[model samples]
Target: MAHHFSPIKFDNKGNIRESVFSILRNAILDKKLEPGQRLVERNIAEQLGISRTPVREAIHKLELERLVTHIPRKGVVVTGFTKADIIEILVIRTSLEALICSIAASKIRPRELDRLELLAKQISDEHGKGNLKKSNQLNNKFHEIIYKTAESPRLYDFLNTLHEYITKFTEVAYSKPGRSEEVWLEHNEIIAALRNRDSLGAESAAKRHTENSSKAFLEMAF
Candidate 1:
């Protein structure tokens, strides 16, 4: 599965498709693309004014990510989760994030902590205003700050995929329950631990945060 970047220009076939891919990915990450929605290529193509070639290719990529699924030529649909999917994702994410946090606490600098504070403040503000998108962006940036602090490229790549799978489900799970405040609070605690260079405390807090999120999501789901 070797592919080139092939810089997508405006007129290129993949342009609209890549555009559509990014939009759809963000939508799903933002919880705008609800689970189990049918993805009709014809409708999507017309909506984005792109030919089917790039759209088809994009769908293939999504399929590989297990984000979208196709059935014997009946077109595609967003993968809907069962309780099992939610549980599995949360478990894996909790472990991975905790590992990252431990590494980060040892290496994160004061300047990096400053950046994390800024993102945390931004997320806290957006949560207060109930701006879900901005809130979610800041929330994501908060984690990205920690993950980037780990300074492991391979870990970053794997975590990015796990992150994509977690974002929408976690957002949907937390948003409805008025849990944004709690979410931000957990984030602030992690930042505090990192700032203090408390490796064990950071790892413990990170695990607790993700585990609590999973519990909240399951509570919402049931």
Candidate 2:
């Protein structure tokens, strides 16, 4: 088990338990700690140069986040989303993002609009260069701008939580064959709608973008 786990580098100023929790959470989200993989507290504590107490606390935190589960005999194992879970997330995202786009189309300021356009072009260029990771980050930035421009902090917070949970795995969806390029085109459509201040068109474009994204993730996941 020690061989399977990597030692965590802790920040000197950070609390041990919080650092442990962050490390473990990121490991789970990154899929290094795979679904159904048993977590050994002793091994983790030893590898991380920490006591079992902090490791236990970190495991508790992970459990709270639904990133890990405890079974009667299995102890704690990483959690994986089901096909149904993915589908439900996608459906919710499509609706919420469409609404966000509609609101943004009506409320977006010139500065924010300019930033969005720049991000779109940057994503397109990065995608053409086969820089999928940067392309995805820019893609997220573009949508995030719209969410911020919507002027609803609570709505953004809620959608952000949902996005975090599902996108941990689906971020790689853009790396699939031609998804990056397709996403650029979809982004352009969204920007065009927003530029025209066409609320309905913006909503439709966002819906279509999410639908295609959902399809890409589903195809890769299943």
Candidate 3:
């Protein structure tokens, strides 16, 4: 674990436990902490230069989130997402993203639409150039604009909880052959529907995009 995490420099402003929880959670999500890797509280506390209490609290939170599990003999171990977990998350994402696009069709302003068009073009260009990291960043921004334009704070917060998992799965999906190009076309369909204020069209396009993404991830990841 020492190789995976650096020592934390605690600032006075934030809760130590939350920070530890975030660090450990991200490690699991990012695959730095591989599945089945044991999370020893004392070792983590020593590595982070924090007291055992905070590390214990962080591990408890991770357990609650299902990112880790307490094995009787092995102690706390990382529990990375299983196939069923991925399916569940993607299924939920499909519905939420479709709803967002539908709401955005009515609410998106001209300037935001313009920005989305630019992002779509940039993502396509980046993909053509084989710059996947940059394209993925632009892709995230493209969706962010639509959701923000929808102006539903509660919905936004709900999606926010799944953001990291979505990002991770999307990265895998993009690695599939022709997946990037397919996503660009899907994005344009979404943009066109939004521009026309066609809620049903936008919703249908968004649903198709997410469903395709889920297919790509399952094909590539499994």
Clash count of each predicted structure:
0, 0, 0
Across 1-222, the per-residue lDDT of candidate 2 in tens digits comes to 323555666554268887787777777666787788888899898888778998999899788767889999879988955667667877988999999999899888888888988898898788888877787777778888999989999889878867555455447577678887788788889888988999999999999998998888877767
Report the lDDT tens digits of candidate 3 across residue range 1-222: 434467788573178887888888888887889888899888888888878998999899788768899989779888987888879989999999999999999999999999999999999899888888898899899999998999999999889878878888888898899987798899999999999999999999999999999999999999
- The alpha-carbon deviation from the true structure for residue 65 of candidate 3, after best TM-score superposition, in angstroms, is 2.9
Q: Which candidate is the best by lDDT?
A: 3
Per-residue lDDT tens digits for candidate 1, residues 1-222, read: 111123345665445665667666665554566667767766666666667776787777778867788877666877745567667878988999998999899999999899988888888788788787778777788899899999988878878877766777666656665687788789889999999999999999999888888887777768
RMSD of each: 6.0, 3.3, 2.6
Cα error, residue 221 of model 1, in Å, equals: 3.7
Output the lDDT of residue 193, model 3.
98
**Shift in Å, residue 27, candidate 3:** 2.3
TM-scores, all models, native as reference: 0.74, 0.78, 0.87
lDDT of each: 0.77, 0.81, 0.89
Q: How close is candidate 3 to the true structure, as a TM-score?
A: 0.87
Better of 2 and 3 by TM-score: 3
Root-mean-square deviation of candidate 1: 6.0
lDDT of 3: 0.89
